[model samples]
Target: MAALQKKQSINCKVLVLGKSGVGKSYILLQYTAPPQEIVQMPKLTTVGVDYKYGTEKIEDTEVKMSIWDTAGQEKYRPIIQTYFKNSKAAILVFDLTDKQSLQDVRYWLREVKLQCGKDVAKILVGNKCDLPHEQPDQALIQEYCEEFQMEYIESSALQKINIQEIFVKLAKKIYQQHKASIPQNQLKQNSLPANEAQNQNSTSSNKQISLKNSKPKQKKENDGCC
Candidate 1:
């Protein structure tokens, strides 16, 4: 039999949703380590959604992530909803420097729940934490997480702080969810067919050896009788 080729892996899609000017694009660019030009800050708004792909290794698994940085304008909300349907996870970013953006986290979370369902994995990110004077109260974010039962974290995309940890935590959570969703019985059933095939092949091999040995003995007996 010809050797089988290694399978190419599919990237996981993670939607980055938040209000305008909350550093969603920056976070993505920083994580991907794109060229300086691509990472350059853009003053213009994202019309629809922009995609950035990144790969990280967690233990033995290689996780490829396609991050969708969605446009936060009210007009583009509907367009962004389409991408959320297949999203495996989400990073709900809010500007720590802007109190209103912090308040708008709830609205983004609601949209995520509506599009991706309530059980979708999510991480609440408080961006611009380096400039604390302009940010909102950390207590308020904690209160919201307590009320909604969501994971919360603080980060500064400009300073490149907690950027890697945020995604690592996200990957870990998604991995756990994926593991839980798979049934143990289904896994056992899937392995059974391969095991049966191997056993059948072994039995057939043994029978062929027995037949060859019996043929030699019968030939010798016929010669002796003659």
Candidate 2:
């Protein structure tokens, strides 16, 4: 039997949702290495969803991720649901300095769960970690993550602290889930037809052998009569 071929890389979409000024766009820009001019935008509100692409390796497979940064205004919330419909993963961000932003995280999480369903992978992020005075209550954040069974991390896009690690961890988690979600039967189904064709060839060879043996017996009979 031929060996199974390696699985192809998968493309995944990850949507970043949070309240305004929570640094969602910055996180995406840092991960994707967008043009310097774009990254230099002065803290402006995102009018609509912005898209970026990033790649990370997990378990010997390259995972190409499309990161979407959705606008956080209340008016834009309903429209953002459309983008979440086919999302494979999400990053829920909140500002460490603002307690209200932390509370808004729950709202964003609910929207994601409602639109993307519970099976969609999620990660919680607390941005602006480099600012000592603005740090959020880590204990509270940890408790929230524990309750939801979500991975949590703190990062500062300006300082570049844990910026890359966040993407790496999210990629790893999605890769693991993607591998597990594919059923063994489906993989077998993909390979079964090739094996069946090989068996058919073997059967044809056996029929040729039987025809050769029968011909020898006929030749011997003809020789005796002669």
Candidate 3:
């Protein structure tokens, strides 16, 4: 048998949007951190634009996720549009305990529509769900999701609630959408990783050893896109 090579990686860029101090950075921190590691989310705020990278397994394919975290402050708004181009999805985050953050997300949603295609995936994330507070208006949440084809999720980065699930959900959705364009022959041939050459007789061609919790080493990036 010919030496098998790893499946080609698909690059998917995702944009994270929300008001300042809404735990946008924290969520990304937890998502990239090792699953078993107890992460300490810092009191950090994005300035211009930042990038976080992680890989996920989508069936036999390996997906490289580039999460673009943009500054929510008004001064950085002018530069945010540059990162919006060709985004696979827009994650609109808000502090669940803060009504104002929830309201601001509507504006964020509008911003996404103006910059991205209608077909672009949008996810409404209510962060800081670990805190106690009055819920945002149910009607508004329903209306927001209805306005655009999107999914709603409540998460708490501090508590590591639903951090992993959100990325997996986004990756799977994006992969499905992109799958139609791939060449069938290429997909079939690259089903196995190069390191698995010893297991050439394995019948499950699409089975991949998941390294989801182990992220590749990368330097922290700010005011940049990856």
All models, RMSD in angstroms: 7.8, 7.1, 18.7
Ranked by TM-score, the better of candidates 1 and 2 is 2
Residue 42 in candidate 1, Cα distance off native in Å: 5.0
Q: Model 1: per-residue lDDT, tens digit, 99-169?
A: 88888888887777777777666788988888845546778788767765568888887888999888988
Candidate 2 Cα errors over 4 Å, as ranges: 1-7, 34-42, 185-226
lDDT pick, better of 1 and 3: 3
Tens-place lDDT per residue, model 3, 112-157, is 7888777676778889888997877888888988998777888999
Model 2 TM-score (2 dp): 0.76
Total clashes, candidate 2? 0
Q: After superposition, how far is residue 63 of candidate 3 from its true place, in Å?
A: 1.8
> How many clashes show up per model?
1, 0, 1
| Candidate 3: residue 51 lDDT (0-100) | 92
Q: Model 1 compared with the native: what TM-score?
A: 0.73
Error of 2 at 195 (Å): 14
Error of 1 at 51 (Å): 0.4
Stretches of candidate 1 off by over 4 Å are: 1-10, 35-44, 147-149, 185-226
